[model samples]
Target: MISAASRAMLAALALAAATVTAWAQDFPNRPLTIVLPYPPGASTEQVARMVQPILQERLKQPVVIENKPGGNGSIGTMFVARSPADGYTILLTTNALMTIVPHVQAMPFDPLKDFVPLTTAIRGILGLAVNPNVPAKNMAEFIAYAKANPKKVHYGTAGIGSPQHMAGLLLNREAGIDLVHVPYKGGAPAANDAMGGHIQAVIATISSTLGQHSAGRLRIIGIGEKERFAGQPDIQAIAETVPGFEATSWLAFYAPAGTPKAVVDVLNRELVFALSSPDVKKKLFDLGLPAVADKPEELDKRTREDHKLWGDIARQMNVRAE
Candidate 1:
């Protein structure tokens, strides 16, 4: 028994409140899919699975990891980009695919416009290594051999146009060495080939190769970081030999464009929190994959930076799909 005006006003307020709550709760009503452009066993996949549970715990939804690798990482990216803007499908990718791919080819979608960048999850540093049996024991010796042999040494990559490929290409151009480019279906295979001596050398991420480097199956001819890997500071950085050389492979998460800002913020906060957790950080650190979280704006900046940087390197090296 209320007046019509009072009842109407109460209903309007309740609807408004419900709409906002619905907007917040409206997201993630179903199983969310996070797409990985790389195949299984990739550091991107490894770290994504590491944090997947944390996100699920926070959101109360099961996160399904989908590996859609191929087309130089375009297939998975395009799939996520074209998905509904309801924040269900996410793209977990590396710098090479998200930023460097467009520079190398005309992709079906614009990375910046088609996807809402979620955040940078982790960054694994790159290292240039060679099999123990190769004539080159160190970076200088390796360069000497390459210079003398010229195109005889096969350089392995995660795949054509991948960051590992770009790293090798950049090193070749900078050092004026001609190493045969060999692209594998994924980084693990490329690393395995390099470790098995099937290929002469590989520029692989620290996370994938550090174990062998420690085990002595592979020798680090040169590393591509400003500083040496911890406990191996005497090993020397590639920049030490060539000067101005540093390349790191990174993993990032993204969502379809037009997703509600509220949902994006919620995920970002949870992701950063999960990454900073001692357990998560320790696990990744032991795996040689360091946790790196960048704000959406910072990740965007890095994307632009890497696109320009890798594009220049690719153009200079004349790197192309092979």
Candidate 2:
């Protein structure tokens, strides 16, 4: 019923739409690189490796992981921040890089402006634990013990500005305790001290000490979360005792800013698939990490809110460079 000219125009429009679709889908025909901001064999690498194989299977392409750690994740973060906005390069990073690093450092790239959200890989819990030699059996007892013996109970942090530092600072402010902080190069050493009874306590990833807690080496007092970790249900949350106190952290993926929406959508869909698989969830759970697959918008909102929250807390408690 249509005239030839009208029919030709309609066909042209259809072709254009098809071209856009193809353009979007054609991306990532090659291997994709996921830049990790942590060192090799780190938690970030483990999470990346766990999801990368599944994503490769689903996409029929490889998702490669590269470690570019240094300067408290600033170096790797900036590398990803400056990468081409073509979805070929992605960043598997912790919220600490987004929420904690920017507040404390003069960075080459802005965390909020330089990246496009892919998806949050996981939400992990952190716990406050002490050597078995400490006289505190629980949160209340620990606070009382620290209050009675000030500066005697030393606490170890992963680094001066790391999440362990944030938890330690938050704990001190909330529990009204002035525990001396000793910074280590990373979480392993700080946790080692806690297990060896050298330092009284240390705030670390639940997975970092899950083995110790299981082996009955260190005494876990409180978790910096609302609920008990599935991996460590015996340990109560700090919120239960501190009432209204909570500090949860996570890891997520981000593409360079201005990456195509179609590519981002594809990545998000694959991540959802990865999270839904029982194998993937089990790996994370065993590592004491809770799986949380968030859309791009949800991740953006949470990161922004955390930045504000941590900023205010750091300021109120006078948690400055150590």
Candidate 3:
């Protein structure tokens, strides 16, 4: 026999679920906005633009791309974090915001708790490029050269605590070489200094160094991926020289915490479909970003793991944000 209190509890639960289902069915009755925590024309923005049309078409609503970049992505990220949990405002950010930034500075919201991971949209492979004058063609040669000239060779990156900086730090630790790290305001300046001989090497994206490498102005030492990226197979993976070496950046989507499960499912299914389209894949590949669509649970697990991994690396290296 069902007691009165037990039946009432069951009825309440059922009513709440039905309400959420109805909300999901009515989602995006208005325009949806994707807040990016980086400036316009960035890799994140480009990837968002590529997927916007697909999302708009599938959702039958205008999808807005808003740039809210600052504080190494914390400013805009926090904005999205505090937004209403209506599934109308989404966060499109890089792994840096979730994994790298928190280790260096205080954030207004908890990365692990303030949002729900939707999916990983794209992955970017970092590459090590050296000026032609440096006596190295691959990771082995580069490591040997740095070893021979301890404290003499310097490498530039976007900034301290940036992914490129972490890649440089990891390389130094794993290769047991001493390469003085020189921080720049952005990757462009770092690449410029490398070309002008101010720095011997630069750890930046493959796209940033590809043109110079092809022109023989810069020699790519190695790529920071376990295997050569399919988009550019000529470059060898750094792991070939240093076993298990891998450092790649990625972008993902998220919804503010407390969003209904039904709304999340609808958004995930449609966006994953958008990311997996052939045309979208080609466009991303052309821009040096590979389209990657993983399940929500998969993205959630990866985010948590990277949060710890980068945090440990930062502490072990004594790296701090500037």
Candidate 4:
């Protein structure tokens, strides 16, 4: 026998549970938005556009992409962090905002607390490319050249505190060279400057410099991966020349924290399917970003590990947001 108040409390709990279940079941009955925290021409936007139609088809709703670029990706990320947790709005961004940015800048939202990891879509390859005029043919030669020149060797990157910047710093520490960092508004500009001989070298995503490298305008000497990238085996890993050196980037999906688990499951299922498609895989590979459709748990684990890894590196390198 229960008191009247106790009975009412139990009934209320049951009603709440039923309501949540119904909400999850009816999710995305309206339009869904994928928020990208970068400019229109970014690789992140390209990837989002690639999957938008597939996600819409599978979810039986219109999926829209919204770009909110600023503060090195924090502006749009905060927007999603504060969005309703109904799974209507999700974030498609790089690991930099979560793992690297917070270590250097003051963030408005807590990365580990404000969002839930969905899955990683692709792995971006960052490469170190030099002007064709540079006499360095490979990583070893480039290191020697930089060592000989000291601070005279200048390397450009997307911006200060960016992954490319960190890679350049790591190379400086590992190779014992003093390559001055020239921060640019974006990777394309940085690569363009390098090609024009304005900068001796540029650390940026391969997609931005691959064409120039192939055209002999800029020469990609090494990549920031533990092993050679399969698509371009000729380019050696910077790790090969400087043991234990690696600085890679990836793009992943996330929803605001407290989004229902059932809704997350639905999203994960469709995302995995779209990413696993052969068409998508080939397109991503051609763009120098290989598809990686790992499970949500795997993404979560990777995020946590990278957060710690980058934090340690930032402390060691004294990296601060510019």
Candidate 5:
């Protein structure tokens, strides 16, 4: 039953499969690039630099970091989305790009559909801090103060529709306070303004606020985790006072959709290995970001969960992207 034409077709199919397997096995013939959606000094960039060396070592190839910050991280993210799905160009960014921004602004790419989740590297522990001049020692006091002096209780965030901003939005809803949002170009500016008392409060990662809090220029009121952040044990969780109030940002990696499964596996394995190093873990802890290198499936699950959670909040609060 084997005609000449059928034999040719079978031979071609077998050769194609063999070619794909060989290609996968011979991946990364050149340098790999990790695209950062925010400018340098942003949390994602910090973590990427931390792991870059480890990745280069594991892959035996140069690992480059490219920053393309804009449109609330959408610009760089979309750039990666449109890149070749050959696994050379990867995306190192925060969950906000996929989880929160889409809910507020129109996007050029569908985050949920355009990228393949690689892994989440770290969880940035956020905290609520107030200027020393504010008459608030804790979340309750701050909420009460904000209620009484709504106009004076403005809070600074990394930018409009950022994770910091979303946390502030959630706090406003749960604590029944009206803290005005003052968006800045980045966390550094926001923290600086908060330290100078130009802004009354700031809800940013503990690392961003730790120096000011330690110098007594800013008073850390509460953390934004279910439990106290490890780096700042004295500060209480915002949930302690405003029950069910918890929000945090995380850094994760992604590759363009249709990237071969074999390539994804290599990246994920190396990433998990890099983050599992003791030195890397300690560095992350010192920076107030806990290492959380979970499986790619877990990142996908969390992305979906957070996307829905923040989407609901965005709709309720009528948040619009600037």
Candidate 6:
């Protein structure tokens, strides 16, 4: 009872489905590559290396890592986005490149449409820390001090449009204070400046400055999570004082768009299994990046939500990268 054209269209769809299924079934016949958008020795690269053996063992393929660092991770990210959807070349990068960078700069690739998220591998919480010279003991006193000082109080971050920078901007809006932003080449330098009293405050990963905080070199006033980090429960969350401030950073895996669902599922399964391993979990935790795993759809949802959230924050703060 169907027209000839309709019958032909159905036949085409069925053929395409079969083709994709066969392609997925034959995936990773050779070596697989994981591209990192940053230089070697970064946390992202470390994580990729940690899971490389597991992936190689499970898939029976050599997992090669390529570092194509430049343009704030866009160079490498774009490389993965343009790769064939054969699941051979993958991307491992931080949430900032996907969720925040696009909002602040002109990117070569579309974050939402160009790639399929495999899963989030690990996450870390950012915190606001101040030099011991700052007359602030906690979030409340810090807010009060900033209100009194205005432009006189300065905060340093890794760079403009970085997660730490965004957190500082959010704090400005949420707490109604002006904390001047000083951009540095990296978080470690920023934290070092804060400790040297060259800057009054710094928004950095809690672990990067935790030792300093414990030694009285820097004082961590508030973390950028809704709740205190389980690893450091003694520190209060910024949200506890600012009501809705949060800035969590994470690393995730992705494949080029149009990748078959079956192939994506296979990668996700291996990733989840590797991340759930006890040794992997302990290593990630020791590095201050707690391992996490989720379904592809969950990662997609989180990516979309974070994309929108960061866009809103960037627009509200009038933040644009140069």
lDDT of all predictions: 0.81, 0.84, 0.89, 0.92, 0.89, 0.90
RMSD of 1: 5.1
Instruction: Give the TM-score of each candidate.
Output: 0.86, 0.92, 0.97, 0.95, 0.93, 0.95
For candidate 4, lDDT tens digit of each residue in 2-61?
999999999999999999999888877999999999989899988998899899888899
Tens digit of lDDT per residue, candidate 6, span 33-74? 999999987778888988999999999999999999998889
Task: Using TM-score, give the best candidate's number.
Answer: 3
Model 3 per-residue lDDT tens digits across residues 104-177: 87878788999998899988779999999888878888888889999999999888878888998898899898
lDDT of 1: 0.81
Candidate order (lDDT): 4, 6, 5, 3, 2, 1
What 10-residue stretch in candidate 5 is worst by lDDT?
38-47
Q: Give the TM-score of candidate 6.
A: 0.95
Best by lDDT: 4
Model 1 agreement with the true structure over 151-222: per-residue lDDT tens digits: 789988777778878878778877788989898877777778888989988888877787888898888777
- The residue-by-residue lDDT of candidate 5 on 1-322, one tens digit each, is 9999999999999998888778888988899999998888777888888899999998999999999988777889989999999899999888788898888889898878999999998998888888898988988888889889976688998887888999998988888878899998778888889888888888888888888899998898998899987677899999999898889899999999998888898889999999989999999999889999988899999999999999999999898975
Model 4: which ten-residue window has the lowest total lDDT?
Answer: 158-167
Off by over 4 Å in 2: 1-20
**Candidate 3 regions off by >4 Å?**
none
Q: Using TM-score as the measure, name the better of candidate 3 and candidate 6.
A: 3
- Supply the TM-score for candidate 2: 0.92
Model 2 C-alpha lDDT per residue in residues 241-290, reported as the tens digit of each score: 88887887789989999888888999888887887689989989888887
Q: Which residue pairs clash within candidate 3?
A: none
- What local lDDT score does residue 162 receive in model 5, on the 0 to 100 scale? 83
For model 4, the stretches where C-alpha displacement exceeds 4 angstroms are: 1-14
